[model samples]
Target chain A: MIIQTEALRREFLVGTRLRRRRVTAVEDVTLTVARGEAVGFLGPNGAGKSTTIKMLTGVLVPTSGRARVCGLDPVRERRELARRIGVVFGQRSQLWWDLPLVESFDLHGAIHRVPAARYRERLDECVELLDMGGFLRTPVRQLSLGQRMRGEVTAALLHSPELLVLDEPTIGLDLTSKERLRSFLSEVNARGDVTLLLTTHDLPDVERLCRRVVVIDQGRVLVDDELAVLRQQFAGHRTLVVELMEPAPPLLGLTGVVDVTVEAQGLRQRLEFAPGATTAAELIAAVARHVELRDVSVFEPSIEDLVRTIYLR
Target chain B: MLAPYPQLMVAGYRRYASYRQATLAGLATNVVFGLLRAAVLAAVVTQRGTVAGYDLPASITYVWLGQGLITVVMLWGDQELARRVRTGDVVIDLGRPWDLQAAMLATDLGRAGHAVALRLLPPAAFGALLFPFRWPERPTTWVLFAASVGLAVVVSFGIRFLLNASAFWLLDVRGVIAVWGVVGGVLSGLVLPLAWFPAWAQAVLRWTPFPALFQSPIDVFTERGDAVGVLATQLVWAVLLLLAGRTVLARGAGRLVVQGG
Candidate 1:
């Protein structure tokens, strides 16, 4: 296993001195990620995702439990583990703000003790793979956000760590930049040399890059399974919207239809049904029998909606 | 194994070298302050012909050297670590493989190097050209003075690191920094030579490691009492302070409460 945790937990002491209290940030979270597996860690805001990453990265020692990254204790052997893993915090820039982008990479290489020839070769590879050649000479403060994030990723990978962990790597990125980063990451995962653990709110990033998904909320894992399996398990309901020719009563009490709501002065009606119990064609046919349909649309559940359902559950 | 320190030093030097406008502005401020302090000290020395073993020339040298070394030793106004702590960016520092204390020291040494060239030399040169400056008589004294200044930088970094690391717990260090700004300037002899203080006060300050920061280097440059002994004291303080800084850092990191999580 590239990463493993048993009964991992962390707590924080917060508030004023007189009324201080301990708040659990992560509790009894057991996880194991094998080498070369790409897993997406999903959660709502303040769900302890970043805290767990911090503990695993040796930034914060856990209040209790055990964590081993690259077969070394994360806190006690942090320096050794640092050599075997790469990390990029999306909101933080590790580059020297005043120096050219390449200088930061050089410093990172030196810090990690990558030999001169190996450093050069890896730099060239990352520069080409991430398409960062044009702005290599520009100072980091002058680069656009997208360009800077690419530089961060390149810096993290210069040492060729065994596992790559990213937190919100695509946050606040434009659509084109987001797609570009996602594709580059997919290529890296496909190489089978690096294990990927990412935490992000962008479900599409997970959909495009991760085969496994772990969903957490309020400091506990709600679901852990393959992305496809999770989707199929929660793919409970599909929405069918139809625009009728004239006003009609709500499409209530229909077979396999769980709920219906009338909209647009009864000209439009949405029917929610279990896909296994009744197919979209069957629902459309049943709605068509009630009234002459002017338009019809079927909506499949998106990953975001599916996760929301899980959270609610 | 030791490769990264030199690389980090170069990075630190380049990092500060890019701030051309800030450097010029800071140099100008140093020179202005040097002139004001020189005028005040020169007046006192001229009236008494010499005070506490310092003649007019030596007192003038003290003022200019203090002004120059203020930036070198970074007596005040450095809250980079504290700010990073408040913003939770120090997590990045902790995550890296290098020892945090050693890395900061190397970077600070690089910054001090830049200050010596741009901030220290220009003002001291200006003082020599424009005032009665006391030049070191021997080449060995010059070397000793250089070593003293370097130790002073390390000692100052040690103290600054401790103050900033408090942010890991305090989460806001402005008040702490404010107190250090005032106390550091006065006790480090930046306001006036420690020799001018009362005998009892001088004896007390001697044990506190503050004089090793500014007084020892300036005293070495001026060929004042016991140059080797003064350098030895500064060296001891440098080592002690650095050790203390490392201990404090480890404790702080143990209970690190990263803000904005």
Candidate 2:
């Protein structure tokens, strides 16, 4: 694995001095991400996603247990781990605010100690891949959020790090920018050299960019598996809605179908079936037999539902 | 395992120069203070003619030079480590490839250098127009002034770095920074020369690190070379403060919960 944590925990001090309180921000999280794997980190508000990312990227030291990024302990060998990882915090920017985008890139390249030749090549690739050439000379404060985010993405990649850790990467982007970033992430993952650990509330991002996912809540891992497997496990079953020309008869005990619930509209009934046992066509046929059916449609529960379940648990 | 130091310093220095507004504002504020100090000295000299070590001319000269060098010495306040830690920006900083304490010190030094150079000249010229005082009679004092100023900067940064690191443990950082600002201002002689203080008080103030930061170097312009020993004492204090700052940072980071990460 490129990144691994064993029962990692972080505790915070809060409230007044006279009334001090300790809060557990992260607790007993054990996870592993293999090299070259693109994994999604999914959770709701206050689910400890950001805290886990901070520990993995070597920003926050764990209060208990241990973590290793690229086989180096982040707390003991931070500089070494820094060379191997690229991080982007969605809420904040790393750019020199008054300087041009290009200047900030040069500054970061220097900080990472990328040799001049390699720096130039990597920066050029970033400019090309992220479509940042148009705004290279503009000050960061002058760019729109989308343009600045592209610059941020390019800056983080200037050193060609082995792993990229993104916290809420698509949080506030518009639909178009979000789609573009998602496509870019997918392409990067497909290239097969860089691994990614993307934390986001956008379920489509997980569906589009990552083949595997790690879901956590209150500092604990709820699910970590291939996207397909997770979908099978907690995604529940697909629902089939049939529109009947007349009142639908009760199909209380069907062979393939699991449940038959009456739609609140009174004109249609909905049927649910497990995967593989009944195809959409078979479900449609099964439902049509109980009614003077006009039409039928099948709907699979989304990954959003699966993640919501994990987070709520 | 450390990268080249000079290259890093140069990069940091250029970065500070890139902030146009802050530099311009610093120069403006320094010149205004220079005018105020020069006016007071001019009024005093018009009445009594000469006082202790400074005549009317010498006092005005002192005010102008000290005003201009405020940025050079960063006498206004220390805003580095404390601000970062309080805002949670330190979360990003602590993870960087460079040592947090060293990197912050280097960057602040860069900012101070720019502020000093930009702010120093105009105030001195303006002060000369307002009052008469002798410039360094010999070129060697100029060389000595440069060395004194470098050490002064080191001592200032070292002390401020320690004070700023206090925020890592304290809840109300502003109150601490405010107290440090008031003490550093008075003791560094930003309000007036330490030479003007009473015998017993001057004796006590001279022993502390404050005089080396501002008073000793300001003395160079007037050829008061007798206090080179005092600047040496400040250099010693600088080393001690540097060690103390590092220890504080190490402990603070280990205990940091890094709430927002």
Candidate 3:
């Protein structure tokens, strides 16, 4: 396993001195990631996702339990583990702000002890892969956010680490930049040389790059399974909205339809149904029989909806 | 293990070198302050002909050297680490493979190097051209003074590192930094030569590392007192302060209450 944790937990002492309380940030986070597996760790804000990543990365020692990254204890053998794993916290930049982007990469290479030739080769590869050649000489403070993030990723990978961990790598990125980064990450993962562990609120990033998904909330894992399995398990409901030719009563008593809402002065009606129990075509046909449909639209369950369902469960 | 530190130092050097405006502005401020301080100290020395074994030229040298070394030792206004701690960016520092204390020291040495060239040299040159400056008579005094300044950087870094590490618990170190700004200036003899202080006050300040930071280097440059003994005291303080800094940093990291969650 490239990463493993058994009963991992961390707590923080908070509040004023007279009324301090221990708040559990992460509790019993038993998880394992095999080499070359791309997993997306998902959670809402303040869901202990960052806290877990911190412990795993050796930034914060766990209050209890065990964590091993690259077969070394994170706290005891932090420097060794740092050499074997790459990390990019999206909210922070490891690059030197005053220097050119390439200089930061060079410094990172030196810090990780990547030999000169390998460092040059890897730098070239990352520069090409991330398409960062144009602004390689630009100081980090001058680059756009997207460009700086690209530089950060390149710096992290210059050492060719075994596992790559990113927290919200695509946060606040424009649509085009987000898509480009996701595609580049997918290409990296497809090589099967680097294990990927990412935490992001952008579900499409997970959908495109991760085969496995782990959702946690309230300091506990709510679901851990393949992305496809997760969707099937929690995302059972699909909505079908139909615009009828005239006002009609709410479409009820339909097979597999769990709920219905009438809107637009009864001209539009939304029918929520279990896709496994009834196919969209069957439901659409049944709805067509009841009314003369002017327009029809079927909405697939999004990862956001699936996670929301998991949280509610 | 040792290879990266030199490169980190170079990185640190380049990081500061890029800020041309800030360097120029700081040099200007140093020169301006050096003139004001030289005027005050020269008056005292000219009236008494010499005070506490310092002639007019020696006292003027003290003022300019203190101005230059103030930036080199970086007695105050360095809140980089504390700010990083408050922002929780120190996690990046902790996550790296290098020892945090050593890395900071190496980087600071680079910054001191830059200060020596831009901040230290120009003011001393200005003092020599404009005032009666005391030039070190012995070549060995020059070497010893260099050693003293370097040790002073290390010692100052140790103190600053401890001050910054407090942010791990305090979350905001502005008040701490404010207090240090006043205390460091006076205690380190940046305000006036330690020799000018009464015998008892000098005795007490000698026991602290503050004099090793500012006073020892100036004393060495002026070839005042026993140069070897002054350098030895500065060396002792450097070792002790660095050890204390390392211990405090490790303990702080152990309980590291990272701010901003």
Give per-residue lDDT, candidate 2, residue A159: 80
| Error in Å for residue B113 of model 3 | 0.8
**Where is model 3 more than 4 Å wrong at Cα?**
A239-273, A278-299
Best by DockQ: 1
**Which residue pairs overlap in candidate 2's backbone?**
none
After superposition, the stretches of candidate 1 with alpha carbons farther than 4 Å from their true spots are: A238-273, A277-299
| Tens-place lDDT digits, model 2, residues B60-102 | 7778878877778887566756777777777767766777777
Alpha carbon lDDT of residue A247, candidate 1?
93
Winner on TM-score between 2 and 3 is: 3
State in Å the error of residue A150, model 3. 0.8
How do the residues A186-264 of candidate 1 rate in per-residue lDDT, one tens digit apiece? 9988999999999999999999999999998888888999998887788867889999999998989888999898899
Per-residue lDDT tens digits of candidate 1, residues B87-147? 9998899889999899999999999999999999999999999998899998899899999
- DockQ of candidate 3 is 0.52
User: What is the C-alpha local distance difference test score of each model?
Assistant: 0.90, 0.78, 0.90
lDDT of 2: 0.78
Once superposed on the true structure, which residue ranges of model 2 sit more than 4 Å away at CA? A239-272, A281-299, B1-26, B227-231
* TM-score, one value per model: 0.92, 0.89, 0.92
Worst 10-residue lDDT window, candidate 2 chain B: B1-10
Ranking by lDDT: 1, 3, 2
